[model samples]
Target chain A: MEQPMTPEASLRLIDEMLQQAKRSFSRMSFYFLLWGALLLVATLTEYAMNRAGLPNGWLGWPILGTLGGIISAVHGSREGRKAGASTFTDRVFMWVWMAFTFTLVIIIISCVQVGQRPGPWVSILTAMPTLISGGILRFRPLILGGVLFWVFGLLALFQWPEHGALLFALALLLGYIVPGFLLKRQEDGLRTA
Target chain B: MAFAPLDPVLHNQLRLAVISLLVAVEEGDFNFLLEKTGATRGNLSVQLTKLKEAGYIAVTKSFKDNYPNTLCRITPQGLSAFEQYVKAIKSYLDK
Candidate 1:
């Protein structure tokens, strides 16, 4: 025979159950944003690098820039996971597709740049497919970043081709840096509440 | 993995305490479970091994930073078993 459980004990049990549900939902949403944003950035960086003719040697600059974005994403995600709050599945398919798109975009952008074209118009023109696809996917962060890239791309063509690289880097700041901090805050809120 | 219902260990109070704690926490180290359940080391280890061998939980051994770690997570089967135990206990209380 067992004694009756106290009210406090029962309430604690309920609290624990609620916490598990919150964690599961937050985790799934976090992964969707993290992977989706990363895939877009990787594709765009590679395209920009080839358009700028920054590649000097055997390895193309676009390839290096895409690789750099991947490393940044992996490091950022691992830190979040160690915080034991916001880990999620790595979207392998999404990443592979990103790499393939980068390869194709670099080829096209390089062709345009090699033709002695100077301006953001070429970059903006190339961005249409990504912009439409990102918006249709309902991935707000990626769509937002793609739009910023498109704006900077137009700037390069119309206003200053020389400033394109700097403006593009600023766009990355708005995209990953801001959202990553927001996600960290969101996780902390969930844990505390 | 499907765990056999009515396993004798599932009926024991101390073992049930450990399982219930694990079910809620996701994963816990041995000392954490011992602290939570108030079970002695030998008894907790025996019950954990039984649960692991029964495929109702997975025990991962590693070093966190530097110190040793023994992390245990309840399997899907364990969650069902825990839920069943809750239902059974409620029925018994109702009687």
Candidate 2:
């Protein structure tokens, strides 16, 4: 007959479960890197186009949007297939980002309809997911990144229209690229050690 | 001088490990539980059956990549039982 589970053993198991959950969710930095790089290119291109008096330079937005959508769909489906277990936190994270994506799409559509640049709206709204995600994960870097998003977001909003693209690009660099790389390093360390 | 009885169903080490994991994450799959517990396939399977019989867990069998997959989730009864088990263990230790 098996021995009864001791209190010490139960505590150990709980610790293991927590560790597993953390390991599973902590490997999401690649998404940050991917989206950040795309947005950086798009924003810089928009800025250049406006400066050069190029017609349809803003077409970068639609191109980037289509490419991003395809990449996300493929990456997400692949991740879903590999995922063996999911926690409540994972579900909450998915919904939070989903809402953010939905809101962003609506804003973009409205901007297109009104013949307005979506730069300011994009910059400000980008903070919501990062802020909430950081809060949910209790990760300080992500929290700080989200705050930086808001700071740059405000600059994008209040600054001259010509500078809006530049501010948005800066936001992506500080908010997404930096945190994404940090997370990637952390995950790598965890996997190695 | 009295101590609460440890639940017979949850008293075993592997079984307790399984429930503890399920309690933490709303659900997990067979391979995930196996990897976490570091238990042999046969032993884990038996423990899972015992938990299912006691109404502490629900198991769903589905196919993935042309392979049979088993997913397990803790039932409400299992959650209550786990809570009670923790309380009972604490009482024993406090004495």
What would the per-residue lDDT of candidate 2 be over residues A144-166, giving only the tens digit for each residue?
Answer: 88888778877776766668888
Per-residue C-alpha lDDT of model 1 across residues A26-139, encoded as one tens digit per residue: 232343345435534554555567677766322333565466557656765665334332212224324544664566466657766687442244345435544443454444
What's the residue-level lDDT of B32 in candidate 2? 84
TM-score of each: 0.45, 0.91
**lDDT for each residue of candidate 1 in B1-95, tens digit (9 for 90 to 100):** 33333445456555566666665555667766665556688878888898888777899998766877678888898778767756655554445
Q: RMSD to the native, candidate 1?
A: 8.8
* Alpha-carbon shift of residue A135 in model 1 (angstroms): 13
> How far out, in Å, is residue A171 in model 1?
4.8
Give the runs in model 2 whose Cα sits over 4 Å from its true position: A1-4, A191-193
- DockQ of candidates 1 onward, in order? 0.09, 0.58
CAPRI tier of model 1: incorrect
What is candidate 2's TM-score against the reference?
Answer: 0.91
Backbone collision tally, model 2: 0
Model 2 lDDT at residue A63: 92
- The lDDT per prediction is 0.55, 0.82
